[model samples]
Target: MGTTTNIIRVLFISILIDFLEFTIILPLLPKILTYYGRDTGINQDSLYVQTMSFVQFIQNLTGAPNDAKWNSVLFGGIIGSLFSFLQFFSSTLCGAASDRYGRKPMLLLSMIGISVSYGIWCVSFNLTIFMLARVIGGLSKANVAIILAIVSDSTTENERNRAMAWIGAAFSLGFIFGPLLGAFCSQWGIAYWPNSTMMFFIVPAVISLVLSLINIVFIIQCCPETLPIAKRDSKQTTITDISNKILPWHLFKFTAIHNVKSVDDIIILRRLGLASFLYMIIFAGLEFTITFLVYNRFNWNSMKQGKMFFIMGLCMALVQGGYVRRIPPGKEIIAAISSNIISHTNQDL
Candidate 1:
């Protein structure tokens, strides 16, 4: 529970690795779309067809003439939305599973799943396979929530903000290095392996796979289970139970059922939840669209885009690590900021 323990450091490192793996693909997405769009011949069975159909629908909706230039942007946005949407669906289930099982087991499982997803991505040959890889990655990722839970389990109310600030800094560090690494590998792939199909994506995917494997090993060796035996859930929750719990009607059922300490407290919580929801929507839109904006406007390749993201990451790290330390924000303000950070940081690339 102490900040000095190996657990916090390991968790921090693990979360950093996770973010690196997640964001490494951001710069490579345009290449992915190009690959699929070029190669998707007469195969109606491909996911590319469905994606194009959806793209066409959007094009029609806006009364805009069809343009090949916008294909990557539209495709990337849809793919990114799919990934985040799946995360939204599965997060509650994963969080509950972590509670019922142990955090260590759940974290290890999630990381391993992510590793496999990256491995699959490295070898993916088609649009369908690549999108499937994204699906697997999205469904497997609930580590951020669990990692934060681990932070909360260990820190006191007064110390929690500072502890979380470090985690936020780690998140920023990941964003800083992840895209840079992607750019390096991408350039390497283009320079040395020009003949290979999907080299642009393969290079970054391989890097992500390697980092994920290392993270998995670190978690197994260093991350001790934080939930005590007495506090662990005894109920053997099956898939059905989890499915039922995550049903739409059940989302706010707990709040409805629980006894409130005060009407004002309930009102405050509802406001926080609403604020968090709106913040996530806006931040996620920005995060997903940034790659498209840079690629189209500045004609930036993966490496140049990575440099831009590196600057953003540097700014984030400076604010979180330096500014927050000098003047710690209040809990409510931190909570709102945390919501924004979680949405932006935890988004799947």
Candidate 2:
């Protein structure tokens, strides 16, 4: 196959899997809560807290605190903490593993892990089970890491921008389609309560599992390993003193080191990092908030949610496809961001 073909194929596969993961699960969450014994957000915007309290009441009465979804917030902090801890723990380690084990195994593991997580999600009556599933899922796979590693190993510096752009396109396409599919499956129990909509998670998990297996057995098998053994072993090269050696990934740290040649570089890097972090946090919260609103405030079914997301996706695609795409890379983008800040500042006035 041509390099271009391979690139497209890889990006398509990665984006497809990611879309399934994100969209399929999200739409059905409304239904998952259906069987939990309530319309939770009924007649009140403050029901978020009320739902948690009610879940707690059930917890004390049933003595199985985890069974109540809303109550997960009350004491699920420990589990949440553990989940975050594991995500941080696994991210770098998984990337390192790909460098050593070759990308295929690590990527395959991630898919399988997530599938199992969703499967557990389908029946997650207790918070502990959900937490465990997430933890295990987080640690299991690093497909993005592996795919990027493959691209790095295969493509030159110049070709990388286009390579990654295509990957991004695939991701966008996934976002465009995954929600609709999830929403479609969600209709299986739209008339029922949110909690009993277990099929939403289950069906997608089954689909993703099949897709992953197809990739693993067919597409992946056709793809050759990019990192040769000699290069891979470089990360684990032996000193006869095994006790003295540190792991490859464990060696990199972001601690303060006084080895900087330019304070300006430090400041610039800090600003960039801070901006990125803020953007990520804001975007995540906004997304979750929107999903919650659509699910609760409207009592919308999966297809509606899917259609809503589809229209949103179409707008986004147009924005990126046309002049707005320029806003990210050049003077235009900087100007646009600047204008936004000014508008926000004026709004505060």
Candidate 3:
């Protein structure tokens, strides 16, 4: 098949697989905790109830005295903002790493990080542990960026878009399935207290670990280095460029990376940055709204909340992946983030 076909294929598989892995937890946690088992435990169930209750209790006073809805929204925004900021930072370093160390190593390392993140979920004792897991996972969170870099290195310019699309599909699938799959696995036992919640993370983490190992042995080993022209060797960039070879990712960091290459470049980058910020803001809002909605409106136990999220995610994935054939990329798409180039021109330009 052609590059388009390949891109679609890879993105389809990657997103689906990842969705399966990630969505499993969204719809199961609440139910699994309370009433799923034949012989529910007095001790364990009580402990779990206390643990989740305490976590939410602590979360409430975490900031201003806003209503629970506002507080939850703020919390979700904080996490998204932090992760977005982190992406800017890690991208620079890891992209640089791809140049020095190679692509496969970074991919393997990132996968390992993901597995460990899920592993922590499996063993979570309380809210602190749960929050910490998200933090850790966020730090190592450059899967898409790193994969894009790998594809850029491996394929020609004409082929890069397709490669990227395939990767996008992988991401979509993961989002769709992660909660659902976690719910399915979490469904295994209802008698235990935290185990109900913990198992969801446990099974996925184990699977993630196995997947990482396979990636390390097979995929990473198989792909060849893409940065054929060494950073130091580029005649166009010059010796000054060699000494100043900063990794070129701008999404994750406040640290400037080789100040916008040109006026046009600056404009382009600024627009993208602002748009990304806004997108995250909205996404954070939606995520928090759903989380609290299930908690208060429905009085859903953890398992029920998980199930709700799973269904929501599945619908989103099917629509985006199955129907929305391809997402356009490049300056036009980037410009889409900034609805009005006129307003941001001063800042971007």
Sort the predicted structures by lDDT, highest score first: 1, 2, 3
Model 2, span 169-215: residue lDDT tens: 56666677778877775565434546653555566556655655565
> Which structure is stronger by TM-score: 2 or 3?
2
Error (Å) of candidate 1 at residue 318 is 1.0
Report the Cα lDDT for candidate 1: 0.79
lDDT of 1 by residue, 270-320 (tens): 666676667677768767778877787678899998898899889888877
Instruction: In angstroms, give how far residue 31 of model 2 lies from its true place.
Output: 2.9
Q: lDDT (CA) for every model shown?
A: 0.79, 0.57, 0.53
- By TM-score, highest first, what's the ranking? 1, 2, 3
Tens digit of per-residue lDDT, candidate 3, span 191-290: 4445444454556556655554454455444444445545422334344433333433433332345545566776666666776777766665555445
TM-score of each: 0.88, 0.68, 0.64
In order, what is each prediction's RMSD in angstroms? 4.3, 7.9, 8.1
TM-score of 1: 0.88
Better-scoring candidate (lDDT), 1 or 3: 1
